[model samples]
Target: MKHIAHFFLFVALQILLMDSLVLYSTGFCFIYVAFLLFLPLGISRVWLLVLGFIVGFTVDIFYDTMGIHAAASVLLAFLRPLVLNLLTPRDGYDSGDAVNIHTMGWRWFLAYTFTLVIVHHTAVFFLETISFQTALYTMVKILLSTLFTALVMVILQLLFFSSKRERMDYR
Candidate 1:
């Protein structure tokens, strides 16, 4: 339920808001990737895959890119649990904790999100570009865009999400 709502909101934001963000020919990034980063750790793989497909397809519709973003987002979703396990905290996670500064601590969450975001962006850019002739430039764009988007995601997490062990709600 929550995941479905989140997926829709992120896709809508990516379609509408991502385009308005511009900077230095690479200063902007669409933040829909945050959905994967912030999702609950225990969500089923099938749910994650579906979330990825929906988010991707929605962006595909908006971008007219023939589901490229959907494919990339699915790739990101597939990689998410691997990254999470690799970065799992020793203290253990609460059942409904949001994977952000609040739950994972700022340092751990930053490292985790940054690493995953880079991977996601790398996959997205290279796949979208699909050629090494312009790989250098495309890599630069991916890095800058990843930085911008990751920064936005971190800020938004800190600002919007409150991981209360008491109530256990994202809102």
Candidate 2:
């Protein structure tokens, strides 16, 4: 519930400011899909889907893009646990800890976030494009946008969260 609220707040900010940001030619998409990546490790699968739907639906409402955000977000939510399973050791994750660079480590979090971001961006762009006539350009745009978004997710996580605090909480 707390996570969902934070995501909604950030999505609101993104909707209001998305027009002001750009990367090269592509726009910077700093959304709360990062929250999807950070869901508690022990959460139920049903809550996972529900939270993804909430965030994605909220983005859809703000951006007026229909189901694109919903599909991409749900996909990311579904993939997150798998990525964590692969990246973190069997006992590495805990339900109480936040999923940030500080808690998950930079390499693990980056790889996890990047993979999900690329997957999400690909689905979103292709859904919006709904065509592959210029597949190369579309691919480039998706890659670039994903890269920028991933950076934003990481930087935000690092800035907002620090390892020392997480260590105290875990202890």
Candidate 3:
């Protein structure tokens, strides 16, 4: 239920605001990929792919770019577990541990977010470009956009999300 709410919230933010965010008319940040990053760790792969598609498709509808967003998002979702496996802590995670920065700590979350966002942005820009004629341009756009998106995602998490333990620390 909470995931559903977040899905909609991200979709709305992407379609309503982020779509119009054009840096230098070439670099564009797609912050919606953060939605896929923060999904509960134990969710089934099938549902993750489906939800990724739904979020991307919804954003595509508004952005008017057809299925590029859908493709990138699905790829990001598919690659998430692989990233987690590579970066998992030696002690492993508790079942209740989430993928958010507050749960995973800033260092782990930064690595996780950077890896996935690069993959996601690469897919989006390459697919959208679909030509080597401007490959250099596309690569530049992907790099800049990934940095911009990742920075925004980190700031948002730090500002809005308090870990269960942190909330308790307030008392």
Candidate 4:
């Protein structure tokens, strides 16, 4: 139920709002990726890939970009678990753990988001460009957009999500 609402919210936000926002004509914020990034930690990889495709396809429909978003998003989904493993804490994630700032701590969340965002943006820009003619420009766009998207995601998480208190299981 909550995921459904987030799907619509992120798609609408990306298409209606973030689509038009371009900073310095280089930085474009694709806040829609936040939907995929913040999914519950215990979700299956297949579901993550499916959801990533669905969200990216929805955005591609609006943007008319011929599936670039979908490809990049699928790549992001594929890379997510690897990133999570690399960043896993000493005790590892609890079953109910989430990928938000509140649950994962700011450092972990930032590292996770930034790493994924850069990979996603690289795929997006490079696939869209399909040439080395503007390699530098594309790299700039990837970095700047990654920064912009990560910043917006962090701010949104901070503003909207409350800390998740530990749950006690009483037999």
Q: What lDDT does model 3 reach? A: 0.83
Q: Any runs in candidate 2 off by more than 4 Å, and if so which?
A: 165-171
Which should have the higher lDDT, number 1 or number 3? 3
Candidate 1 residue lDDT tens string, 37-132: 778877778988898887777777888878777888898889888887887779766656667577567788878877877887787777778899
Highest lDDT against the true fold, candidate: 4
Record all residue pairs in model 1 with backbone atoms less than 3 Å apart, i.e. clashing.
56-70
Model 3, span 1-171: residue lDDT tens: 666777888788887788788789876778788789877676678988998898889888888988999999999999998998898999986544567787778899899999999999999998998998999898899889988999989988888777663211111
Of the two candidates 2 and 4, the one with more favorable lDDT, higher being better, is: 4
In candidate 3, which residue ranges exceed 4 Å CA deviation? 165-171
**Candidate 4: tens digits of C-alpha lDDT, residues 76-127:** 9999999999999999987556677887798999999999999999999999
State model 2's lDDT.
Answer: 0.77
> Which one wins by lDDT: 1 or 4?
4
RMSD of each: 2.7, 2.9, 4.0, 2.6
Error of 1 at 100 (Å): 2.5
Model 4, runs deviating above 4 Å? 166-171
lDDT of 2 by residue, 1-171 (tens): 566577766786677866468777765675667777766677677788888888888888877999899898898888877877788765676656667677667787788888889999888889988999978988988888888888888777877765753421322
Ranking by TM-score: 4, 3, 1, 2
